[model samples]
Target: MTIASENTTVFDAVTIDRAVRLGTATLHEAAGRIGALPSQIARITPGQSFAGPAVTVSGPPADNLWLHRGLLASSLGDVMVVTVGGHHEAGYWGEVMAVAARSRGVAGVVIDGCVRDSDALANVGVPVFARGLCIRGTDKDPDGVGGVNEPLTLGDVVVYPGDLVVGDADGVVDLPAARVDEILDAADARIAKEARIMAALRRGETTVDLLDLPKETR
Candidate 1:
């Protein structure tokens, strides 16, 4: 059920569901603890959590024209992954955009910038993961430098269109589309191992004994 566009294969629904179930923390660990978005970017709306393929967008600081374009170009179940020069003061997104994203079936939005209309966005029910909330409005300048469906860097991560994006209370993690299957398998194994460790702990085992850590010296 994968869809291809511009030589990129969007992850299928099955893969997205599996990743959502595995969650960002487990997937991040399974991917060798890489692919974490900046800690400043976090789930903004109430109960906000989502997993989907990225629809990458980049725009000039304090401008949102390209974000609109990205939303329009996105398909059902795509997450709008946006980078706006790491600007944090302007409200590049809000309630209106959340409604539009919902109409387009965009699963969520992860922006390395601020957003506004916090209450309305929460009611709109489109998951929004953003850097912060700002009331300063952004300009829809037509001449602003921007791009949609292109690779964009957020923090130290280079997010590509069609890459798997999983976000939750713990924060967002980007997984390479090609490595999703392997990562998921590794996550399952990690979960099983953790379960065993938890069981051992319940049986009165100590972390130093179970994990073979060095003993504390007086």
Candidate 2:
């Protein structure tokens, strides 16, 4: 079984709200594509979405002993960023854990493995993101070293605890805690620019001219 560090520093709640508004796609771009989770990882439910500082967990493959410990260690507004060393078959999480997470005000979960009881999890009400679903259960032996509140490598991305984690229909992306403000500023500019483009579209402006492309005879 794995465990967590004693450190509990979290990102600002207000900043998390602001980043959530930007959405994963926007933050992905704003962060220069440096922190997006693997593409294979997707939301278990269509509308599940949230943003917060991550509580990173690295567990043994095919084992969930670390999951329970991670849950106990998590805090309000914490997003569980679980790395299972790419174990994609076993269902390491399920409905019961969802309920446990919600009781503590945990925002959501993103696992580099599978989660079961999708239907039952709906009742628990915490957003979950994972590679997919599985019916397999995990062994309950919390008897090994696990990493919590530490940096984790999940698929193609590396997530650090306290980094901003955002999830939406587009998928989950982690933004460095230190870069949150800078990226939010960029996201705000992008949003404003899109508003102008949308207004131009409603007024019948062609994409060619709106983007200042050189005029050409077709």
Candidate 3:
């Protein structure tokens, strides 16, 4: 499903933050627990964990001119999500961009390519997720692409604009727009149930007894 830019709405930062605080596991389990198809590309910069509305970008591999332009055009509180056609050869994000983004009130960046300047990024406190770290630099020309606010494939899943995205130590999960409320409710219920189970465990209840499993299963 290709989402058109005109149809895409970048959600408010408050909304995304609220969703993140709700509970990571609940958001995942409610969304059927589908993980991002790509494995471990995003590195959360120390002291830079954040959730916000997505500003999606798409461009050619190994080029980031468009990304630079996107940064300039992105609004405050937007999380710049760059899809570099899964290019992992060169670093598309670096300390310079992170600094600029922070000044612009950008939430963070999620790139399908690579990033560099890890120490600087950590020091500057900008969260970044990428395929990996690479010292290889990207060309500013010949590889520039377009930014369509539409739903673009990141890793293995289609991320629609305005859909909730929560990323923590566990991983990133894309929440379906229609199911956000339902998932939040489910998460609340799950938390309540877990609380009771935790109390029982504190009282020396075994897993079998807490879960009501049979002796044969235990």
Candidate 4:
């Protein structure tokens, strides 16, 4: 029977932590040039990075009814992913929400729209990434509803519930939990290849020579 539940499934803590420790950029490379969120989604507060499974949500331009539900529905280590139907002018998330999320052990929040309370958010103790900040508040529209654990897109990547989400100063990225091991393996190879290139440079080889750039291009 079909049923509704607030609980969102997630990957193991160790797997997610390892991906977070690997950083978003490496995962992008590992995932074969995919999984990086748009550059427009940026860190509002500095010095914190996070990795966790997504709990997707969305709503209209300035209604945050879904976000309120997301907080109630989220579990420890679940990162809230909000897409506001291309609305980038509402402060749908802020200090109050950040505080609530932090208390729930929510890893972080990524919003396609705007947010506010930058200073207050800085002290809220959870990382937040958004398109920009706005002081305008959202409406508690009774007509508004948002889905959780659904697929989400951020211009640069698509994310699903339980997908590994890694974010930092570089940006955010998503990887299907089932593909984590394979992607990490590729990342390891890429790192090794870069290491070899660095070693060659230490031997006084020019980058152009090591990379074999076209003579005319150099």
By lDDT, the best candidate is 1
Models 1 onward score TM values of 0.94, 0.91, 0.84, 0.91
The 10-residue segment of model 3 with minimum total lDDT is 1-10
* Model 2, runs deviating above 4 Å: 1-4, 212-218
Residue 186 Cα positional deviation in candidate 3, in Å, after optimal superposition: 2.3
**Candidate 3, after superposition: displacement of residue 37 in Å?**
5.1
Candidate 4 accuracy as lDDT: 0.83
Cα TM-score of candidate 1: 0.94
Per-model lDDT:
0.88, 0.84, 0.71, 0.83
Instruction: Pick the TM-score winner.
Output: 1
Tens-digit lDDT string for candidate 2 (93-119): 998899999998999999989999999
User: After superposition, which runs of candidate 4 have C-alpha atoms over 4 Å from their true positions?
Assistant: 1-8
lDDT by residue for model 3 (118-176), tens? 88888776678777789998877743555646677876788776566666555556676
lDDT of 1: 0.88
Query: Model 1, which residues run further than 4 Å from truth?
Result: 1-8
